[model samples]
Target: MRIALFNDYRIGSVNGSRVADITEVVDTRWHGTPYVINEFIAHWDQINPSISAAMDRADTHELAGVRLLPPVPRPGQILAAPANYRAHVSEMTGSRHRPANAQALLSPREVGFFVKSPGSVSGPSDAIELPPIPGRSFHHEVELGVVIGKPARGISRERAREHIFGYLVLLDMTMRTDGEHQEERTMRKSFETFTPIGPFLVTADEIADPTALRLRLWVNDELRQDADTADLIVGVDELIERASAVVTLQPGDIYATGTPDGVGPVEAGDTVRAGIDGLGEMSIPVTERGW
Candidate 1:
């Protein structure tokens, strides 16, 4: 089932062009505080039956006019892979005049991952705010976002799938410059409005294979990124296992499985649309942060 947060953070199950409100299905009073995304995911299994029942009811709203927010507005962590795609790595290395040696094509085990600030998260309708730093070129990295369903630590690669809640289309908006170093890379990436995720959170059961999906991104009408997840140097399972070994994967944590090549700079007034085959697509506007 497709789950979404729309029109004032109300949770609902999404059908074609319609959404059945299921916000009341789960008991949201968490010892006086309203149930947040993390609490909701913790109780998902128990509340799922009621959500399904709510979807069957006649009371529904049109999906088109509703405003959709990031499925998890503020996740506990946002783990992201860098240079995980062979083509993407090659493009970076060749452009920088680095030798395309075996050392350059590091595996996921070697490259590890980086943590993006949760404050960078934004929804589908939100604008990709371009930072005003001169000489900084903003680019879009379309990736398949993985949402964790349960808390896990040191999970095995064999059982990694059990922890996943679902998937979504994620755009890792970035600022790049020539000859950027490691520390500069993280600083540029952590800017506000850098992560745009949403449209829908497709349940994992609905997806046949996460590693076999096609990812595509466009700047206005021009296609900038086009590649398959099959090209990933380190697939989803290993990403979860390896990441979880270092830090506990909480229910509302998100992992962006890196981007393929064809990443290029975007300017103000550009509309960016990115999608994963079954998950969904997000089209967000780009605007300059007036300095």
Candidate 2:
């Protein structure tokens, strides 16, 4: 079942044109102080049955009219992979004098992940606020976002799937610099409005294989990125296992599997549309940061 937060942070199950409201079910079941995304994810298993029953109710709302919020608005942590795709690494590192050699690939073990600030998270329909810094190159990295369902620490790769709640299409908005000794990678990616996630969170059961999905991104109708998860140097399972070994993975934490090749810069007024094969799509507008 596809779950979403729509119009005023209401919880619902999404179909093509309609959404079934399950807010009441969630409230009555969880009895939490505030009905936030974290609470929703924490009680997902308990409320799943109720949400399923509410799907057939007659008071569904039009999906298009509702404002879609990030599936997990305040994810405990936003862990992201960089150069996880061999082609992406080559594209970023390839020089005018020497072309990248695919044979010399660094495993996820070698190139560990970075944590994007949770404050960077924004809804899919939200505008990507371009930093006011002039001459800074801003790029879009479309990735598959993995939502964790339960708390886990040092989980085995074999059981990694058990911790995943579902998946969503994520746009890792970045700012590139030319200086040799630049700011830390995490700092570059932690700007507010840098991470755009959602459209919908498709439950794990719906995705037969997470590693075999197609990802694509378009900037103002221009296709800038197109690659399959199959091209990932380190797949989802290993990412989860490896990440958990460092820190305890909590419910609502998002693991953004790295982007594929075709990364490019985006300017103000450009609209970026990105998607994963079955998870769904997200279209985000771009705007200059008004300080």
Candidate 3:
């Protein structure tokens, strides 16, 4: 089922252009925090039955009419892969997008998974605000986001899929750093609204093969990033295994499987759109400074 968190943190099951409210079926108390999404996912097997039974009788609304929030409102951690795509690595190694006087690029095999501040995350419809950093080139990177459904540490690649809850379209917006003052990637990527995710989360059961999905991104209606997850230097299972070894993976934790090539800068007033097959898409506007 396509699960979404819409206006006022109401949980819904999305069907086509409409959504049916399933919030009542959930048994967990939100405690006044949208972190309820985490509990909902963690107990999905137990909670899904009630939600399914209620779908037919629940109140429905147009999907476009409701304001959407990040599927995982406050993830415990936002672990991401860097240079995980073969083309992305090669491009940064030699392409003009490479930072000036930078060392040769490294792949995930060498660098491993990195963490970004969870505060960087925002809803799909939220405008991406650029932090005040003069002479900075902010780039857009569209990637597949893997939401963890269960806790796992030292998880094996063979058992990786078992812990996954779903997938979403995640844009890893970045601020390019020069060689003179090389900055940490996490800091460069952790700015507010830097990680805009979710049109809705497509449950893992609905996706046959995550690697087979195609990802596409457009800036102001012009296509820029286009590729398949097949090109990832490390696939989903391995990413889970590798990441779990470093830190405990919990429900609502997101693993941003790095982006494919064609990354470029975005300035104020530009709108960015990205989508993945099977999963949904989102459009967010870019602005300078904070809200």
Distance from true location, Cα of 259 in model 1, Å: 0.4
TM-score winner, 2 or 3: 3
Model 3, residue 112: distance off in Å is: 0.8
- lDDT for every model? 0.84, 0.83, 0.88
Model 1 poorest 10 in a row by lDDT: 96-105
Better of 1 and 3 by lDDT: 3
What TM-score number comes out for model 3?
A: 0.95
C-alpha TM-scores of all predictions: 0.92, 0.92, 0.95
CA lDDT for candidate 3: 0.88
Writing each residue's lDDT as its tens digit, candidate 3 over 1-68 gives 89889888888899989999888766547833687788789888888778768887899999889989
For candidate 2, give the lDDT of residue 36: 64
TM-score of 2: 0.92
Tens digits of per-residue lDDT for model 2, 39-146:
777877887777666666636889988888887888888998877988887776663212233224465778678889999999887899997885467889999999
Candidate 1 stretches greater than 4 Å from native: 30-35, 56-58, 96-105, 179-183
Model 2: weakest 10-residue lDDT segment is 95-104
Return the candidate ranking by lDDT, descending: 3, 1, 2
